[model samples]
Target: MAPAPRAQPSPVAVAADVSSAPVSTGCGNGGPTTHRGLAAATAASRTMYWPLLRNAECRHGLPAGLLDALVFQESRYRPLVVSRAGAGGLAQLMPRTAGDLGVINRFDAVANLDGGARYLRSMLDRYRSVPLALAAYNAGRGAVDRWGGLPLNRETPDYVRKVLTFFNEDA
Candidate 1:
């Protein structure tokens, strides 16, 4: 006799009302409690365009998870995100760097990611250390070389640690 076919599991159902709760107005009457849901939705949308992790991994030998971590640290995966220093896109490529990397459209998801990854790879090869490479990526290669290694700045140190931690966690 032939074995019986296995039944497919049914999809889980979520409560619609759960996402439509009342928000705290801080006055008296509550507003809409969709802040968490909205934030999550926004984040998911941002991740869709996070090309550094996806495109770089596909074309430039960069790790997707590392790219994701970098994007998280740089812009929290926000494609429209621009730094105070004028860096833009998911990977936060500076205008000059983006131009040098041949990123014609810095806002284009794929272009930005590829450019950032290539730049990162070049820095890594030059530094021969992930920490130093990341420091260079953040602070600049001249600064890294000037210090004879990674700088002793609190922000750079924390940034390196955070990226490494994210990398390790994802790995």
Candidate 2:
């Protein structure tokens, strides 16, 4: 018997006009960092960036909600986020990687999503496995090459699981 089809979640429209919605850092301990606050922020971000996310998904032939899950894991849709490793924007792209991906302004939401999606597509093409591709995205292509599969490292495996879980749940 065949498996049942997955139902994709419809994009929820924000009550406030998207153009006027405030952009939150989606991180840090400062401000209203409660669970509800974070959920609200994530929802707002989903609405605000739905168009860009969908565009990236279509352009890169990525499974629906995959980029959204990655974005949620990376920066929670914060356009101004900078990681401790110097990764920035909604996709948490490192400076070198962003430049290599032709993303001049990593802080720009659209460009960041495009670059991240492109990078993920490359990984998927190379590895031909969602878990392996996600592992490479979280760690690096070099690491995936070194391990020749999903690395046994703690963070990479955990990251892959979380992203996949989110991706499946969002479906």
Query: lDDT score, residue 48, model 1?
Result: 62
Estimated TM-score for each candidate:
0.71, 0.77
- Enumerate clash totals for all models, in the order shown: 2, 0
Clashing pairs in 2: none
Q: Write the per-residue lDDT of candidate 2 for residues 120-140, one digit (tens) a residue.
A: 888877876677777788889
User: CA lDDT of 152 in candidate 1?
Assistant: 63
Q: Report lDDT (Cα) of residue 131, candidate 1.
A: 64
Distance from true location, Cα of 27 in model 2, Å:
29
lDDT of 1 by residue, 1-171 (tens): 865333222111111111132211222222112222236855675546643355564455454355655766787667778899999987899999998999988778888878888888787567655666677889888767666665665577678777766655644
Models, CA RMSD each: 19.2, 12.6
RMSD of 1: 19.2
Top model number, TM-score: 2
Go through the candidates in order and give each one's C-alpha lDDT: 0.63, 0.72
lDDT score of residue 76 within candidate 2: 87
